[model samples]
Target: MVTPTESIKWKRRPLSTMGQTYKALNFEESVLCSPTQYFKRYIPDDLFTSIAAYTIIYALQQGKSSFNLPMYWDTSLKVNVFWENISRDRFLELRTNLHLVNNLEKPPENKDKFYKFRPVYTAIRKRCSDLPIEENVCVDEGIIPFTAKFTAKQCVRGNQVHGESMSSCCVESVLLFQVLKSQGINAVGTVRQNRFGKNLPFSDDKTIMKQTRGYCEEITSADEITMCKWLDNRPIVLCSNFVGKGSVDEVELWNKKHHKYVKVERSEIVRKYNHAMGGVDLFDQLISSYIVFIRSRKWSCV
Candidate 1:
């Protein structure tokens, strides 16, 4: 049944409160016997060979002879080996004819800009997706970062999304949850306040703050999506289909006012979310730590 988010009454509990202890699946079954087997998951040997053959053939077509090497090469008495047994001119000749897809069998350029790069792109995406999907999938902001200035970013305004901005990326969580529900996969993720949908009542930040630390509340949409707001150092909202505010537990949180760590309440939803999303939080931490801090007025300065 297609239930609207507004039609479902706000419930303070989970859709399923079954006391199932969390079990994390190990990688033993997904593991390959050897390094070669691991490597084949993304790039199979046959696919690699086909790519090499097509690329080489295209290079031959670009220059029937290696005489057209760039003037930058200087064509001096020095022998600059471009790639063992291949010279600058020969490499240029090969590069000019390089084809990820066979040049003869490629589709129209307008149909797909990825025609030449499709082979490698499809291989990795398809192979990785072939792995088993976990039930408690931790959904995070899946936006890839790009800070480089480019012509495409400017040209695509109002046409399609090219780069992700903080506001733009955070604004679409509600719809993301709904789509994941249709796939029959469970999801738990932190959602922006703006994405809470409509007609749903939630206490304002001031009201929530007035309550004791760890005081929590939740509401389930008519469609079974649950949103929980919990207080610790600050109020955080977690949206889920698999869990919500259940039995409360205490966790040590730094009390900035007191300058000490104190026990704060954490419910099942918060605990479940933190546990399931530990890897994602770690990944975010790693990437943020290494981000290039270049000062640029343009958003595309990646």
Candidate 2:
């Protein structure tokens, strides 16, 4: 009989398969799309019966994201966390042994930084591409929660953002904007100071902040390219082939040190970016709300 380790190895690289009319697909994107999709694909007949039996009871018992495993195994009742359906040891073994892909088949070290989630991420990218393309679309990175220790941990994590990322100012310039303009597409986005034209320079955030909070600087090219920097709660720089500094309007901004909202002058360019960028934020918010929570160190499991 094949042992668990051997079985896992076999899964990582399937040696052979029984005769089939078509390739057997173990992992399907729709299965990961929704709870209903998951139940439909995996356990259609037993889905409702099992959920009615155990799912609601466990959910009512505790928080959705707050399952404590070590605590569950504790001998003391006062400190011990409990699950009605499974023992802690058994659950741990199940989690540790679970294999979506063979570790041996992982991409060479550093070649693919996130080899673990490649399949899931590729699937997500595929699904995102299948979505209807609009003239205005924004690409932002998605966050996958890792409760345990990891090397690539970052302080910031937000919604299920995914798409084709816009190039940084390093890759974006008057030349690139001109190309977009030639294609009848106007581009406007936030830029960093280091790569934004050196000949056309603006004061740093500290210098700008030292002046009136509404202070701003603008440089417009003969061909209509605009480079703008404004100081509000912070210094922000923007570059575009089309939009430039227009009517300055007052908007409320939270003054953190003062603990109140203060009126700050906002230019038309900033206002337009804020209004349009809402589409990206909305996309992230909607998908993030429905992400399935799987308790595993692997980002792909989520």
Candidate 3:
């Protein structure tokens, strides 16, 4: 029998199988598109693999203009090996025909919106599942900017760019939570205030200042799921199964009246939430700073 204190060990392996699966699915989609076309002339599996690698490298190497024929020209970037190997026409052809999953088959009702990128989605989820769970795991949402029309696209108000509103679950946040709990990993996250029902155990009459400065409430369900709600500028709520209730810490808060920073007693839940909630946001920020400016209709490619 496994002890509660024991950690789960993850196996490390190459993701070549995922690449092979992608190639097969993409080739099938391409074949289905042009069944009458000559098989001998069709793009080979090796060429597709090369194209995938080239695309990733191109995205990494930034250029003045977006990914276009001109960007890969000799005059623009001298002695470019990638551009010389693949012709412009062939690149465009592959880009146009690339497909992750077959559209003919109807997806399940719940996953219909995300059917287009289902293959890539599944691959990512599998990769996440294979990773070892950390003792302290944080969950948060990250938006993928996609102006193109897609069923799963969500428009977040106040964001400068319009795009799909993917929640933390896209990165397997909920799955990680469940898995980590089984291994005794602590998980914390800031959830939407409205997620709580109207019949909250805590009173709604609390002032915003009182809540934001320092206030914590512990809630437990019949199933023994421990959740916490604390006040800090706004109502910050979290669900942490491993953390104990009533733990407090001192945090610095700005006082508008006195025009100085004041130390206030804050709950441990608030401190942990503030410290751990930025993993996804930090990732989004880093990618946004250096992301390739290429535009695409496909949400997955974007």
Pairs in clash, predicted candidate 3: 211-231, 212-231, 212-232
**Local error of candidate 2 at 40, Å?**
9.4
Higher lDDT: candidate 2 or 3? 2
TM-scores for all candidates: the values are 0.68, 0.49, 0.59
Task: Give the alpha-carbon lDDT of every model.
Answer: 0.66, 0.55, 0.52
lDDT of 3 by residue, 103-182 (tens): 44454565566665555555556556755554345555666666666666666777676666655453222344445555
List, residue by residue over 208-253, the lDDT tens digit for candidate 2: 8888777778765545556678887778887665666677799998
The runs of at least 3 residues in candidate 2 whose Cα sits more than 4 Å from the true structure, single-residue gaps closed, are: 1-93, 102-110, 134-185, 197-199, 203-207, 210-212, 221-225, 247-264, 279-302
- Per-residue lDDT over 26-75 for candidate 1, one digit per residue giving the tens place of the 0 to 100 score: 65575436877877878888787887688777666765543445334444
Which is superior by TM-score, 1 or 2?
1
lDDT of 1: 0.66
Q: Which pairs clash (backbone N, Cα, C closer than 3 Å) in model 1?
A: 58-97, 59-94, 147-300, 147-301, 147-302, 148-300, 148-301, 148-302, 149-300
Model 2 CA lDDT for position 299: 33
